[model samples]
Target: MTDSRRSSISSIKSDVKSDIESPELPLDQKHFGNTLDQKAQAQSKEQPSEETPSTIPNGGLVAWLQVLSGFMCFMSAWGMVNGFGVFQDFYSSTLIPDVSNSDISWIGSIQAFLLCSATVFAGPIYDHGHPRLLVMFGSVLVVFGMMMTSLCSEYWQLMLAQGLCVGFGAGCLFLPSIAIIPSYFTTKKAVAMGIAASGSSFGGVIFPIIFRRLEPRIGFGWATRAIGFISLTSLLIPCFCIKARAFPKTRRKLLDFAAFKEPAYALFSLASFVGFVGLYVPFFYISTYAKDVSGLEDTLSFYMLPIMSAGSIAGRIIPGLVADKVGALNVLGVCNLCASILGFCWIAIHHTAGGLIVWALLYGALSGAFVSLQPTTVASIT
Candidate 1:
């Protein structure tokens, strides 16, 4: 009986081992398949969640090309505005001799007003992928304005050409360059913008010298045509080069009133307005003031422009670097205060040559600070 029980137990153990080795147990098969599926699903989830790298190339041929394009655009547009002093002098002396300084001031004032005020509408339009059209239209208007201006023999005609047409054109051209910049670059944005903004200063330098030399040799018509040619050349590069990157597909509203919800923007706008009011007065009046009040020669007066512009070159660059460190608003506020003081000083020391020179130097330095700081200030607040 004992032998029979031992044999039975061995047989049962063998049967259990055979059952464990079989592949057709339904519960075990289901659990194994489920485990494999869970692992695969977890891996699939992780694969799609990986971050994408940026398309903005760091300091290569394409990057430099973008910088070059921006420089060209800015030089063509803002450069002309900086060269307004030459126009002011010529128009006041030749075309509208009867017009007072204040009366003639309207031309430049209107141009500046249109240039800035158009930002209200142009910003949204540019953000919407119409940059090429905007830039082309601006080029046409600027060129046409110059062409018409060369033919103008009257104050109103000049105003229409220089103030209305050129101003509007500049606004159109400038919006794209400014708007497209932030799209292409984030890390190198300041450097890129600085290089671009220098175009104005460069234009300021080149145009005055050109106007001074060419006004004597070629006369006003051909001199202007020369400037127009330079502008045309500079304007063309942006048409091909400036492009938006990963811009949103949705249409932005015509007016972004949402921008004003921030108190900082409102304050900046006010400060900018006040700063511009003081800023342009000197640029317009300095040559005349030097010629009439200080008894400087015409050539010397013209030379003052480039000198001030030279100061401005430093102004635009140095403050940009400082703004990154100390805060743009702090730098800008200090700049405005300095500009105001310098303006008062100019008014106070109108009769003395040394004082006037000091004022110019000081004012130019302050203006540079203001120019550099303003953009930084806007960026900071925005």
Candidate 2:
């Protein structure tokens, strides 16, 4: 009986060994019973691999073209927005003469506000890899709004045409202009941004001069139409030239409320909110202020906005250079402090064009620095 039991156990062990060594079985040395070689081959076939480069191509023709495109975006969006002082004057005197200065101020304020506020929606759309589409649509809205503004004699019409339409359009263009640069650059980011931001300063100078120069010859309606044509031409560069380097693999929220939980982000956001509220006050009102308080002629008062914008061109570029060295946040802090002081100093410059000019130039420089460095500063902390 013992002999028969031993023979039966041996036969069962032999059967188990054969099953383990069988060629048809899926099990292998790999974990979870995966056949190592076959699994690897299957993965290779299913999803092709891409090698990530070690370094960003910080300086190249393509990168610089992006910068140029960003520059033109700023020129068309913020440049036109900054030049609203011209409109503020025009609307008060010629178009909507019955409206109070406070009511007229709302038009420019809304334009500036929506230019920034629309980014909440724009940023998410931009992230999903549709930059050219957004820019093309924005360009159309901007030109259309400007043309519509030309024909508007009433307050509500101007608000719809310029404030809501142009502001939302500018918002669409603004995020992609600044956001794409960081993907292409690392060390030279601040300077690149500064250069791109200086486009607004240039626009600030050119738009006012354009409106001021042509308004008399062409009349307000034609003058505005001419400005619209110029905007259409300028906006085309961004629509064609700008391209993004990378896109996120996963989706993100339109508003990243989690970022606000960090103290630095919260404070910085609050400070920016407070700072910008008053910053554009000078840009929008400086011309009107010059006319009211400084007794400057209408022609001379209009030039103040352009001069301020011109100073900002230097402000944007130079601060960016300095920021890359000393750190963007540090430079931004100094600029903000100086800008605050300059804001108060505006009160003291009464009845002198030269004083107002100097004030405007200094204020413009400091404000421009703040504008250019702001994004860089946020990038560092975040």
Candidate 3:
């Protein structure tokens, strides 16, 4: 780089540096350096930098760390929530035996509902740059709620502790991880989400088996406490590492109900709402259904959720790469259709363990794909 060329580029300022990458000026003594300097000086005055900081370090150590934190966050939040089927099964038989099946199901239902919906509110807060505190607070509620669950024997007590407290904590902690992801990635957002969301798939695979193995050995209270301790450990990294980058100023409206004005967004929201209606149906009822109608033994019935979740591991992974190539909405549409078809087929698999296992595999993969792709699709749209 010649002195003249360097002087031309450096004189413009930080905004110019951000808006354009200055070319390496040649050191040729004759034509090249002087000509480039004249052009750079003229171009600098013509184009004004608009104060947009190009801070998206798309691939770097910090960015990968963000992805790592997101993985742990998803594991702790949605992955933890995915284990609710185990709790539902356990609670119905032991802690709250008198409670109606429908009533017991509500605990998991509400937890799943809150785990996703709270994101609507938490997202806005995250855009404002307070993820660490929000996560820490949520971690406390979740761990404390778990500790409290060990003492609760009544239906209402369990409802408030496990359903509300744990659910609320999970909900609050969930969005920041997902919401921060787009800030660091653009072209590979779907794949990053797939990897991060796979945490939940693993959670689903592990937590249920733990609950089943632990419950008989340690009883409900201590088993739940053990799970809580695990959650505490899973949450520590995300609580410290997840940070938002490149979001707009916080003065923007928190809840933009006006986004419904866009027909595409409105329909997308409706589709998501419709999807959620059935999303938890299988996870919440697998054990109960296996026990009640499939006539499976208690030990076998408990494995249904674990099997479904294991299938979901693939669901979370493969569709992401596919979405990256063909488009997120395309993959989501296909998976949602598969899920709908599998859901209808679910009615045919009664009293046969083989049939139930096949259904679990198909539905679990479809559901996992849907869950993993939805966030990427939302960000991709418009």
Q: In terms of TM-score, which candidate is strongest? A: 2
Question: Which whole-number lDDT from 0 to 100 does residue 7 have in model 2?
Answer: 100
Clash list (residue pairs), candidate 2: none
What is the model-wide C-alpha lDDT for candidate 2?
0.87
lDDT of 1 by residue, 1-382 (tens): 6999999999999988988897465888899999999999996654433222365554566666766776787677777777677778877898678987778878888887777777678777776767888888888988888888778878898889988998888888777776666555555655566667777777777987887799779888888888888888888888787665544445579887876778989877777787677677777778888888878878887776666666666666666666666776787678778878777667678777667666776676667766544654677678
Write candidate 2's Cα lDDT for 30-147 as tens digits. Answer: 3445567678889676543432444578879999999999898898889887898889988888888999888988887898888888888887788777888888988998899999
Best by lDDT: 2
Ranking by lDDT: 2, 3, 1
Candidate 1: residue pairs that collide: none
Which scores greater on lDDT, model 1 or model 2?
A: 2
Show the lowest summed lDDT stretch of 10 residues, model 1. 45-54
Arrange candidates, best TM-score first: 2, 3, 1
Clashing pairs in model 3? none
- Cα RMSD to the true fold for all candidates: 8.2, 6.3, 10.7
